[model samples]
Target: EVTGDERYKDYWRFLHDGGMRPYIQRILDHSNATRGYRIDRLEALAADGIPAILETRTYPKIGAWEQAHEGKPWYTRSGRLEFYRDEPEFRDSGENIVVHREPIDSTFYEPNVIVADPRHPLLRPRRPEDYGADPRDVGGDARQARHVVLTVDQMLSSRHPLAEDGYRHVFHTPKYRHGAHTTAVDTDIVAIWFGPFGDIYREDPRIPFINEMYLDINPLDARELGIEDGDYVYIDADPHDRPFRGWRDNPEWYRVARLMARARYYPGTPRGITRMWHNMYGATWGSVRGSRENPTGLAKSPTTNYQSLFRTGSHQSCTRGWLKPTWMTDTLTVKGLMGQKITRGFVPDVHCPTGAPRESLVRISHAENGGFGGERLWRPARLGVRPTYESERLQKFIAGRFVRRG
Candidate 1:
């Protein structure tokens, strides 16, 4: 509608008619190699709509079946498995071969620190002045001189700014057992199973359990910080260039650029490491206050029924993007099925710039308003009564009333 182009409408109509299946069939018909397997009964081999190969058998196992059975070569310049890469982009970034590189943000080093292995021929050695190390004692042997290593005392005292400011815990977001990659967790049934507070009913005054975020910390770490399980705490990450610039004298300091969550003492978590379930909801306009010019609060106006679940912040408040040079290369390469086509440097779904949310650091402190037995605590409603007919069916099944005899 914005462009007013009729070609886009035509394209949409084309897609709506038969989707990508017709295009895929055309490709199979034209290709000499795949022409033999293009039979009418290909869809019958698999229950799912799309079949990987147009053969009588099920889909082949990834990385194993194609090379072993069909004598197909792997995707590479040599058309086989390769370890060493001579690509200019790979050599420039010192990632030609598999090697461990420290996270860009969550580390003892300063933010955006330049890390390089002295053994790598293309990359330069770390400067002694950059790390505040003595010039004479730095990089004597190339093999021994890898990345700059800092002692615990040095890290806490001088190296890490966050550590010096008492933000010692390394923050990471891992997958939750109840949810499948940010889906189905919003429902009350799923929310009740995880976190310290159970599901919040629709009538509850507090935020719904789906939008409530929680932090998992080691028991020892919690003890050191005088934190107890199920206590409300404010999590503050590096505020330099993150959610905001400077910390102003706002009445609700916790509501600005900081996350509030219930602290869970988990002994299973490693010391100095903290975890939160990934994909928690973010804040809305109603959750935040306006600037001084427009001081009237939207949350207080209540003209709209769109209530924000979050009090202030989000999971991405601490995260930032770190782009790798190699991923942005413009070098042309062979890609696609059977390496039949030459494409640009960027390979779809394979090579791309990605964000590192796991590389984050935070500090936790007890919230002044909320604690054990406080008003902020959520009193979860009990599960709803089961339906009569469903209950009868379950009872009958248990009693073998529906059993079949042959």
Candidate 2:
């Protein structure tokens, strides 16, 4: 739509109409493949004959695979593995040499904080006096290594908006076991084992068959906050760009800008870290409180909304996207297969425009009404009904696959 090219509307139809073959042929034409070895048609991609790109019948490995078999050079400027980078962007960023750098916002330092390790031969002090140490002190080694610390000035900076607010826990969203990335976890079968509450409303038609998002907190952290297992809690993060900010005053939205989730005490989790599945659904027009004309109270959807199964809010409520400067570089560089080098601008995920969402710090507290006390509970008539043959079979399958008989 932005390009106003109608042919680009239906990508599948465009490909079937021979719009993509030209691009494929262009790559093949530029490849080091001999004219006779290159496939003339796109159908040859699935043909029995081996394609020019495939060096062997076995799986192809990246790096040196082509260099060892064919005489093609590596994709780097020097055509060999090198530790030092001479790019101006690298020099400006102080990342000319590969080094360990802490996370942007997750760490105490501001975004892109660089620190030198005292253990490194080049960074070690020649004498104890060089680092303001007592020259009279005798030690086995010079302990002049500097560590990253949260300073009063850094806390007051706008970049560390939540630093002074005492939001200590690091919030992270990881993939769900039952889902493929963000997909499939919402289904009834997958939901049975996905969340703290599991699929308790599976048989209720009024309620969707899905699990509510929950926060996995270490037992020590939960105890300190007076949060017990299965207790409803509100997770609040940096308010600069928090979720549902516009609906803060809306009476219909409960605890706007804060994520409501059940707190699960997990001893395996670290004290300062919290985990939530990344597959939970987000709020939609149908899930939002109130009608198009007037809005009031939660779960007052005019239409059927499965996202309401998410209960209060999504995991994203405590997180925001962070863009890296190195990822935004427009420098033309050589990339692609060894034989098919393409000099182009930054390619997302490959080089540029990467979104980092795990840098958020959050604080969790018990909700005003703990547990599901004030919420409208779904107790369908089928709850006490006798199980049918189909239900029995499904129960048996679930037991065999997920639950232990003992």
Pick the lDDT winner.
1
Residue-wise C-alpha lDDT for candidate 2, range 1-406, written one tens digit per residue: 7999877766556476766765566566665432334445536665856444443423543556767677667566766656776565554444555665445545433433444443443332223354576644321122112123223454335243355677788888877664675463546576556754654543322222355567888867877887666666788776545664555556355443357776766777887888887776655555554323222233335566434444456677766665554555666365743535665457656676556365467778886433343332212212321122124546667568666767
The deviation in Å at residue 1 for candidate 2 is 13
Model 1 spans with C-alpha error above 4 angstroms: 1-71, 108-159, 184-186, 201-211, 245-257, 287-309, 332-342, 368-406
**Per-residue CA lDDT of candidate 1, range 1-406, in tens?**
7899988878667477857666666777777546755444566655557664534233442444666678777556666777776677666555566655555556554433234445555553344455565644411122122234333344344344567788788888766764676542555465455555553442332333333567888867876886656566777777664555454544355464567677766778888888887655555444554311123322221344343334456666666665665666776354653345646577765565675355577778887323323643223211111122135556677679897887
C-alpha root-mean-square deviation, candidate 1: 10.7
Model 2, CA-based lDDT:
0.55
Q: Whole-model lDDT, candidate 1?
A: 0.55
RMSD of 2: 11.1
Error of 1 at 226 (Å): 1.8
| Model 2, residue pairs in steric clash | 252-297
